[model samples]
Target: MELLLLEGVTRTIELPDAPPLTILSGVDLAVDAGDRISIVGRSGSGKSTLLNLLGLLDSPSSGRLVFDGQDVASLSSGQRDRLRGRDVGFIFQQFNLLEGRTALENVMTPLLYASGRQFWRRREIASAMLDRVGLSHRLTAMPHKLSGGEQQRVAIARSLVREPRVILADEPTGALDVETGGTVMQLLDEVARSSGAALVTITHDLAIAELASRHFRLDHGVLTPVSVHAAEGLIAVSGPAAGPATDAGEAS
Candidate 1:
């Protein structure tokens, strides 16, 4: 089943003195449960813009976004906020952990503001999630006290604490060394697959995108799927044929 859908989506931002810039143009995509999709592009290629839209952090200029068969554009602001909290989790390029909060506390944050759960119950769930992410020993350590990989794991724990249905990751391994990045990517893949959650990762590195189940590239406001094998060792590509889908306008 389709867990997420985008139809004829477009986004345009007006510059201070320049003409309106089209970040995304008539884009269509459908993501199913347990699907690991990657979005790749160079700087200023609308990859981030499209991700923001998928995460509900930004609205498109026109078109529809549907989640779990419901039209997201038809939801109220409060409804959208609730949906974002309950159905979507985000992993940013920057770890974005609270400096003062311990790893456990950071992971418990989503439950703090969450409704329908007792405080003690939330804590138990958060602790279990941290333990699952291999941060059981670092539970009491502050974000600054942990290694880069540990910090990222804590962030992952936080994102997973709420049991979200989908995860939108923006350059999730950008800050780590190659070995560490591979480890992190493996962890992400394991968690998403285990939980049956759809995953969308945005990155400029083809190597990183190779970790996903479906590989796609965004360029000049278009999205195309490239063969996973072809993107394995390539560093930079400019053509649409690099992926499996040549139609820059849609994805199945």
Candidate 2:
């Protein structure tokens, strides 16, 4: 199923006297359930802007964004909030956990806004999620006490606790060492697959990007398909060259 779709999506920031700065220009993408997509770009390449758009944290200046077949631009602010909380999950590079809260409490935070039985059973759900991420023993551990990899695992648990349809991971392993990052990525991919959630990861690491089934590169607000020839260690741009009408990739 097509969980998310973007067509001619453009984002611009206007300053008082200066001309408008185009952050993302005519970006088109289609993400289906269980799809793994990695987007690579350097700093200031609008990678975070795209992630914000995908996670419903921000809207495009011009164009359409569809989530679960509904036009997001048409949704009321309240409706958009509900949709984002219920259907979309985000894992940030900073491991945005509540500093004073325990790992379990941080994981249970999302369920506080849930309805009915879910809200009441938040602890149980959070516990199971943490366990799934191999952090069962760290339920009472504070964010400061956990290592970087463990903190990221806690963030991952929190992201998947709602069983969201899509997972938006922005530089999820950027703060960890290479070996630890690899392990964290493996756990992330495994959990996403088992839960049947589409994974969209944004990062500058090509090795990490290669883990996804499809890859794209964003430069100066332009998005393009990237074909990685593993054997030759070559990365090639495949279609659309530059624009919002560019194709992302085939769905697995």
Per-model TM-score on C-alpha atoms: 0.90, 0.93
Q: How large is the C-alpha RMSD of every model relative to the true structure?
A: 4.2, 4.5
Q: In lDDT terms, which candidate is top?
A: 2
- Cα lDDT tens digits, model 1, 1-252, are 588899999999999999999989889899998888998777788988998889888888999999888898788988888899888999987999999898988999988778776355887888898889898888899988999999899988888888889999999989988898889989988988899989899976567777777877777887765644334344333365443333322221
Question: Scored by CA lDDT, what does every candidate get?
Answer: 0.82, 0.89
Q: Best candidate, TM-score-wise?
A: 2
RMSD (Cα, Å) of candidate 1? Answer: 4.2
Model 1's lDDT to the true fold? Answer: 0.82
